[model samples]
Target: MKTIHLIVHGHIQGVGFRYFAQTTAQSKKVTGWVKNQEDGTVEAVAQGTENQLQSFVHTLRSGNRYARVEEIKVSEADQDQTYAGFKIIR
Candidate 1:
């Protein structure tokens, strides 16, 4: 399994990005959480198989129609962090 933490910048907040991420993650069978940051960025942590994570990353890059993602900072994450499913954190 693989896990990734991503900080997405640009027109990401208030653009249904969290829901988009949740749906995309579920489709890829990944478990994660998406949350909005005070700095006007979107943060997420996804865990799944390497293939699943790769596909999820692609979806993140593409984003939803309302989101104009300018940058996504990705880093290795602990696979031990678990979630029942993808969720939008407040």
Candidate 2:
């Protein structure tokens, strides 16, 4: 198992980025949360097998047409065993 945090930049606000990310995470059996940042970036955490995490990142890199994710910053994260499922944080 692995955990990763990602800050996605460029045209990531509105346009259902959080919803898309949540859907992708659920389908991939990844657990964590997604939310908007104050600086117009999208942030997310994914916890699961390394393969699933990689796939999730790939999907984020090439988001839905409505979104244009120009860059993503990823880092290791502490385990969050309490997270039950993927969601859009308030």
TM-scores vs. true structure, each candidate? 0.94, 0.95
> Which lDDT tens digits does candidate 2 get at residues 1-90?
899999999997989899999999999999999999999999888899999999999998998889998999999999946578998998
lDDT of 2 at 21: 95
The lDDT values for all models are 0.90, 0.91
Pairs that collide in candidate 1 are none
Best model number under TM-score = 2
Q: What value of lDDT does candidate 2 attain over all alpha carbons?
A: 0.91
- Compared with the true structure, what per-residue lDDT tens digits does model 1 show for residues 1-90? 788999999898888999999999999999989999999999999999889988998888998999998889999987776777888899
Cα displacement (angstroms), candidate 2, residue 41, comes to 0.4
